[model samples]
Target chain A: MKKEQMTPTPLVQAIGLGSAKAGFSHWWLQRLTAIFLIPLGLWFVFSLAGVPDYSAATIQAWLRSGLNAFWLGLFAVTALLHARLGIEVVVEDYVHTRWLEVLIKTLLSLAMASAIALAVFSILSLVRGA
Target chain B: MSQPQTSSRPLSPHLQVYKPQITSTLSILHRLTGLWLAVAAAVLVLWLYGLAFDASLFQALTGFFSGLFGKVLLFSWVLAFNYHLCNGIRHLFWDAGKGFELPKVYRSGYLVLAASLILSVLVWLGSL
Candidate 1:
């Protein structure tokens, strides 16, 4: 007896044939951000943990150091990026309404943008010895 | 017309049907850590904003954070940090298209748990 073979659909041929294809970009971004944060997050925690108290000037002093500032900026950016990606996945998975999903995604994007802006501003201020 | 698949009021897998696994604990811990970090970040924002505003406000805020409750919060922060960091590294490996086999998955899961706990303890001991 001869067996029939499976064939790809026209739509599948037009666009790559798989569920894993589309979501991979988002997955990679999330992983990239996570990888970036591994060491930077550790540095942030260790650097801040040593401070005797959370005094304003002490915090400023910590941020003032070049190494600390570098890691702080890295952490800031990676964290905002990671949070946005994670939240986006959650919304995409759970939020079914088209309008609601769009709204949530937009809000998350804005939040991430705001976080980066604030972080950059603070980093610049510290760098300028403000 | 054909009938729809998976539309017979299909039964879904439930917890009781399967034995518990180590990765399940790690998954739950990841969510819990995410939550604790959110709380810590909120407190951190309050501190940063207070410092940005005025010295008096900063003093009031710092006083609270340095207090007993604050210490507890920071402890949890470190715990969450360690857990998330180690588990996140595991996630990174998965993202790289590795560690799909059963033994490797369980092994790495246990390693992540052990490392986070050890690191958290060391940090706590060092801080004291």
Candidate 2:
């Protein structure tokens, strides 16, 4: 009796069948955020460096400024997103246990969410002078 | 804890004794970059927290960051960030089962180095 050969799906594709494609989306998002951050990150470093006597007022004013806010917010959000994705990869690669992986991934997501919230809150405080 | 007994002879570790391969170099560099990123993130979190705090703290941090040592650390972070980001993407391709050929391995290695240099120069110029 000849049994038909069945092809095993690639690991990359296998992720989606059980995991709802979240892993792939996260990986892709990390790359996308990295692409977005490169120029913005450079601009931010330069912008901060050129400022004179970077006091609290000066820093607040910069964050409050429309130009600075846009870049800062983007960087903050994208950085957290990318970090979450990166950390998730590290966790998945090294943390072999099923429950541990899920726990770590969940914790990472929560941390990223908190960081973004803190960043936005901080920026808002700066903008509002509070 | 029992340490593994070694033969009563001098022995070199794999890295010290073997000719370096791309995969080995890439693995070591990846871990190094990861450690660098961890340190960089700590610095960044402090900076952000400083921003949230009152003016004196912000000024203090800014002053320190403008100093020579601060600049060097910042430069190192920049290099590590660029290198890791580039190499991580390369890993993604490998994960997808692409670029396993010898030629592509060398090509991507050079690409990572070149891209890091260009980005670093652009960053320095922007800073100045």
Candidate 3:
């Protein structure tokens, strides 16, 4: 037989085409962040609810407290991560056009990175500015 | 390779074909609220940035939120946040291999909805 006929085509499903090895980490990290956010989220809600005012001084002082600053910062970071992961899945599910999906995902990554960066910076500034 | 014609082939599951169930509706709501929360979180980060960099900006943002429209939006965010949170916990339970029974699933669905409502009310009330 000729060389073209000798080798059979590879099985697509068997090779798992369209599989990104990154899925498990994405899923696992999403869950892990969710777990962390449970306490962080609750603490944030209750603490903010209890705040007497949203005035600059009051908000600043509240965040300036060591534990509050620590937890809020942690919460911000974790929740941002979780949100990015969730958004990625949403895009993957609904975005059918390959290029548009790619573009959106790329933009999402950039935006999420900036958001996380600004969140950290803002939190730090709050604590330090206090 | 030649492409196989698929015009006559049976298509995959579409939203129009399936009757909506509590489980499916809630699942979609979880995703929808998750997206809303992501947007809410970005706004929150922006609020933090305002507070950190410029107190006047923060005050302006706060002023806007004190309005009626803002109040509605803020309340919706609180409800969305609570809904996502409670439903997320339900998802975690399923991940743990529990709460798979149909009756249990329906019970938990209602429970999540009630908890979300109560939590949102308590939060708004507590803030007031």
Predicted structure with the largest lDDT when compared to the true one: 3
Order candidates by TM-score, high to low: 3, 1, 2
The residue-by-residue lDDT of candidate 3 on A1-130, one tens digit each, is 7887763444533464566578889999999999898888878887887899888889889998768888888899899899999999999988877789999999999998899899899988788874
> Candidate 3 docking category?
medium
Model 2 spans with C-alpha error above 4 angstroms: A1-20, A49-53, A97-103, B1-19, B27-35, B38-42, B55-60, B63-69, B85-101
Per-residue CA lDDT of model 3 for B27-99, tens digit only, reads 9999999999898889889899998897788888899888999888888888998999999999999999999
Interface RMSD for all numbered candidates: 4.6, 6.6, 3.5
Encode model 1's per-residue lDDT on B1-128: one tens digit a residue: 12123344534556677666787878778867865675565455445545555567678877876799978888889999899999888877886789979899999999988999898887877666
lDDT per residue as tens, model 1, A1-130: 3335653334544455447776888888878888788877887777677676566778887777657777777787787777777777767866867789999899879867876777666666656666
| lDDT by residue for model 2 (B1-128), tens | 22234356565565567888776787778767766775666456557766876556666777887899987888888888778777877877887899999899999988987887787777677657
- Clash list (residue pairs), candidate 3: none
Candidate 2 colliding pairs: A56-B55
Q: Residue-pair clashes per candidate, as listed?
A: 0, 1, 0
Output the number of the DockQ-best candidate.
3
lDDT at position B61, candidate 2: 72
RMSD of 3: 5.0
